[model samples]
Target: MASTAASASPPPAGWASDPGVSAPLRHVRAIIADHLTHGPTDPTLAQRRAWRDALYDAIALPPDVVSTPVRDGAVRGLWQSSPGARHDHVLLYIHGGGYEIGSVRSWRVISAVLARRMGVRAFSVDYPLAPEAHFPAPVDNVVAAYRWLLAQGIGAHDIVFAGDSSGGGLTAAALLQLRMLGLPEPAGALLISPWLDLTNSGKSIDDPPGYDPFNPRAGLESFAHDYLAGHPATDPLASPLFGDLHGLPPLLIQVGGDEALLDDSVRFARRAGSEQVAVTMQVWPHMFHEFQAWAPDLPAASAAMDDAATFLDRALADAR
Candidate 1:
């Protein structure tokens, strides 16, 4: 059965001005401002490493229940409410860092929230970043992690793949790659403001001043150039929006209306519908990418996550 929470109320006008802006929104804005101010000025390698470390240190995660290093050399993280918790259902979480930064630790809160909301354990993978690893490597790591899950006896129907931003793009790409490999599709997938078009074809991406607080056009273009190296942007694996959507599991996509990636999600939904894939797409007005990560305090962010949880529950139930 599908379940949902009431949508969170919008923040008041000029909410950003008050010293007492909601704690979650404050944190969210700080992160965004930091990215904008310091992201481009730092030496590239140092910036990448700092971003990686900050993301890892930001979230408070539950104690590790299991740690498995994949045979292919990627890090596999398992966390649950309790150490001995036996969970058949699994969430394979891929962290987003524009394809250059982000690790399992960086997204601990998001994974933890999903784990609690879905009543399942979550396994986050620390995939290799670009410039060092480049395109296909992250996808390869995600696929390898999925195979590792299967090797541990987790059925495809019991697994739900999820990611935010670049990781979301990777989740979609991984599904396409899985189909190409003749592997069974997972039960469902969730994407938050996925960066699906490295080609930067989305007109919304170039929209005027401050539309998306987090993702700027120039920043994204730079990241894409770094991540893809010399690869063609239109390659289906590199940009999943160009891939065939047939036979993939149900999908839930949440994106901010103001984000440059807005069109990516909209176009993806259109294609998925044409391909007869079950898809749910939500657009939050005036919000930014991955806003749900600031949940539990930001009413809109919390509501968005609650909706995601509800969608995931229904999809998982249907898989069963």
Candidate 2:
């Protein structure tokens, strides 16, 4: 049976000492840390998009994976698939940039790799960003893409939802919305370093035991403000960490043990488990926020993707 227990205890004791953090991984971490420290404190939306894409897209995708642009209804994204991938199974991916930045092209480094690894097609949605479309817009876009998938004859049991950072939060909100609509639930979900708490109320935000090169508290506050657009931060759809998780599908939350948002996954797993949801939360020691994006070079990143592929395969097989 699948483990429902949440992983990783609080305070993340001595995560920086993990031997798995190789020299290349440390160099990558340093580069990102320097960029976060010295880069523009307040960047325009265009500049943010350019910088994020340039940085993330630098991580190349597997050569065998093919990518194609997709535009249908409210669903705008990239479809990535490897040779011999299953046509019956699909991975609905949401790219993360705090709901402000990130695009389908930028996230191919992640979703595409998972597609190749799982031998399945992955649809990475390019949802409307904050300041462009706030509140429920991104959530609605995800729901519409899901509906489009079903229209293509894919069963709910053959699909698995996955997202990183804010996209992860959006995935959670979308699941809640699906439940509310009385729609069939997908097989399961993978939340990658999910930023589920928009209020920045988690203790890890203020005091993290390990180094996290992501945005500071004020930056997160600004992003949340833009996305919320006067909506209450505590609103379930806006912040799933603050929402009722009952009846949601099984969840596998993979978070970096060293990321400041570690508590977001830890606390979310705790609450979901308390509500009888099957939750598997893995805290990767010495990894930073969304470290899975640095795969091939980072051993831990490849390992994380390996774990994700295993989970996705098992979930879909069990559903069958």
Candidate 3:
């Protein structure tokens, strides 16, 4: 049964002393703590992009996966698949950058691993960013990408949408858009540490920061401001937590317990269930935002991928 409770109970786990925390992650955490204590507060968007990409690229992809650029009119994205991928199954991956910073290149390796491990073709869209494009632009891009996938002869039942952070927000937004457009639902969706509430109004946001040192409330506000650019933050498309989630396909929502956006996912799960949507909200103890990006490096990340692969595979297989 899906949880319709206003507040979700935190899952049982030894958050503080998780042995799965990798040496690399610990080292990275220390570095972030040090940076928080002594690094520059405001960095140019370009600088942030470069730094984020470098950090993401540090985790290598399996050697055999192939990646290629895809351009269908103004819809540009990256397509990834390994030798063993099931051609009939596809994953439309949305990269998280708080609607501003991420790119297909920045998220290449993790999506590549997702493709290889799940044995499905993966497409990561290069949606328009904020300060350049505002709300509904990226939403439109994702809708177009879905149509493009359909044009590729892939059935809606074979597709799964996966995203993290703002990309996860977009996934939820796109589902609502699809319903309004009368398009068929995909097999399912996977949301990793989704940022569903644009209002930045979550209990975790104010709770003293735990293991997460990167996501300052001020930094999130910056992304929201750039993305909204004077638009109301409560717009349904801007914040899916406020949107009606009826008739959407099954959703697997994974959020780290220590992050500010934990309530976004929890509340979303609650609301979706109220609307009778199938929702599985999984909370990882002591994890930070978008931690799955460190896949194959962090044991927790890899374990999350396994759960994702299982969910996507089953959903695609069971599609009516």
Candidate 4:
């Protein structure tokens, strides 16, 4: 999602003439820049959602993929799977809207495409959002969803957790919560441009060196304020970058080099590595936040998804 002019930062260096930049990439950047520049400064929730959905409206699911609504306990989400997807393994995806704006509908395209690529059943969670639910509610909801999956006869080892932006942060938080609750860890987790620091302390937030048209520091701070809702920003669960990550499963963190949250992934990867967790981090040059959502339209997006599939295959190979 993007911010209004009220929260937008000065545009970063444009990539129009950068070496190796593609025509499609330049066009995508222009589209995002124009959209954010012309957006309402005080958009209502409905307006924000519509804006987001329209941005990716052109991206479509494969014809063979099916999206079915399902509810188990507190978990409400869509079950998406393609023809060759394995029924037994689960890919539990949490969408990113800084814990405020995104929904199952807005994220269905990416979720469906990922399920198709990974050859697994995907359950994209519709967790409670902020300025309403706030703080630990989202984390609690995700943990409950994982438990519901287990109750449905899915093995913990056969499940892989994946999410983008704040959802990526929540993925880490839920893994920590799972550890505290004595629940088994999943095979691995994939985090895309994760906003893991509610404190907004990452150096990149203040000093970005590349082009990131979407997520600005002021916008991220506003989101943190609403999501944290008076809670301490440094609380490990709220900002999983502050958590103990020792026993979590293997992690593959893919972040855009130019996004404000780049440091969140770098710092978390450093901490996770120091804690002896198997963590792989990739930084895509000249890219912005959640760029993977662009998929086939953006070469980097497709490559990022391909890397994810490889990571998952390696993680799930033991079970196979």
TM-score of each: 0.85, 0.91, 0.89, 0.94
Clashing pairs in 1: 55-106
Q: Candidate 3 lDDT (Cα, whole model)?
A: 0.80
Error of 3 at 247 (Å): 0.6
Tens-place lDDT digits, model 1, residues 194-250: 989899898887772234654666667777888889999999998999999988899
Off by over 4 Å in 3: 1-25, 31-42
Q: Considering every candidate listed, which one attains the maximal TM-score?
A: 4
Model 3 over residues 1-320: C-alpha lDDT tens digits? 11111111222234333466656566555534433343323456676666556656666788888899988797999989899788888899999977877789978866888778888889999999988898889999999999988998999999999998899999999999999999998999999888899898987877823545445677678788888989899998999999988899999999887887888888899999999998998888667777787776578888988998898888888895
Q: How many clashing pairs in candidate 3?
A: 0
Residue runs of model 4 more than 4 Å from their true location after superposition: 1-3, 6-20
Model 4: which residue pairs collide? Answer: none
Error of 2 at 115 (Å): 1.4
Q: lDDT-based ranking, best first? A: 4, 2, 3, 1
Please list the residue runs of candidate 1 whose C-alpha ends up more than 4 Å from where it truly belongs after superposition. Answer: 1-15, 18-27, 34-40, 52-75, 78-86, 208-210
- lDDT tens readout by residue for model 4, 1-320: 33464244435455544557778788777767666666666678768767766666767667898889987668899999888789899899999887887888778777788778889999999999877789899999999999999998999989999999999999999999999999988999999899899998999987775766557776787788888889999999999999988988999999988888899999999999999999999999888888888886888899999899889767876544
List the lowest-lDDT window of 10 residues for candidate 2.
1-10
